[model samples]
Target: MTMPQTITVLALDVDGVLTDGKLYIADNGNVMKTFHAHDGLGISLWQKCGFHIVLISGRNENSVTVRANELGIEHVFQNSKNKIADLQSCIQAIGCTTEQVCFVGDDLGDLSIMNHVGYSIAVQNAATEVKTASDWVTSLPGGEGAVREAIEYLMKANGTWDSSVASMMQEHANQ
Candidate 1:
């Protein structure tokens, strides 16, 4: 498995990739999902390095919108029946090519986009076929800091991980 020479966009599938593939529905029909703090920080770090983040989900859940807003992710496509098309639109909107995108997914629905991106990643608990199609698989499961693991791997491969961490440490020291 070879890493992309450059990755400018990080495209993600929301359900199984950001959450643990579990859904909570209230009696009133409100759906809820949990996101990991570690993954949040990892995303922040990725954006701080000047990369873009986009979210594509097959379901239309308000929680996903709320979470994306909290993370300052501007490109969000929910209720997407065709992930590849949404991803292509996102790539165009961001003025980047498919070779500059890395997609992390965990299920069959994510397979199409995974195959279309430059680097495809699957979480530890991903479906067998999804894992087989991926360039890399995270050690952690989804909603368990798996996104963080993928971000660190990409940053390390791009030679930005050490410096980014150092900058964060220096900032903490000053604080």
Candidate 2:
């Protein structure tokens, strides 16, 4: 599937997309989530190319905030029961349109926004219905570099992958 040529924002669903959809709760009732480092680097690369990233999750968790901060993502909407609404607000705040957004999801909660965005992507382990509704499906499963895979696909589609990689390499060499 061809990516939307004007994509400027990447909206992500956290639980099933950034994570494996498994919630590890301690005896004290704190929830823990594991994020892939590869995905983090992918986000960094995407940002380096001057694109935007947003996280929208139905459930609120502190770890999500921590991770988003670590990645320097400014638009994060947790405890969002209505993802479409949150997405709209995000686009408005960022001065972008839905036609410039690509949403990556892995479950039913992600369906509404998927249909509204310019491009919809599903992780490999996503629900069958989600995959059916997606424009593209990643080869890797969620929490296992699927987000990174999606980022790479988007970068390539937008014709920014080669230059972004070269820039990163140059920066690393300078360091």
TM-score on alpha carbons, each prediction: 0.96, 0.97
After the best TM-score superposition of candidate 1, give how far the Cα of residue 117 lies from its true spot, in angstroms. Answer: 1.3
Model 1 Cα RMSD, 1 decimal: 1.2
Please give, for residues 52-140, the per-residue lDDT of candidate 2 as tens digits.
Answer: 99999999999999999999999999999789999899899999889889999998878888999889999999999999999999999
TM-score (C-alpha) between model 2 and the true structure:
0.97
Clashes of each: 0, 0
What lDDT would each prediction earn against the true structure? 0.90, 0.92
Every candidate's CA RMSD = 1.2, 1.2
The positional error of residue 41 in candidate 1, measured at the CA in angstroms, is 0.3
TM-score of 1: 0.96
Candidate 1, residues 57-155, lDDT tens digits: the string is 889988898889999999999999899988888788889889889999999988888888889999999999999999999999999999999999999
Instruction: Tell me, by lDDT, which candidate is best.
Output: 2
Which stretches of model 2 miss by more than 4 angstroms? Answer: none
Off by over 4 Å in 1: none
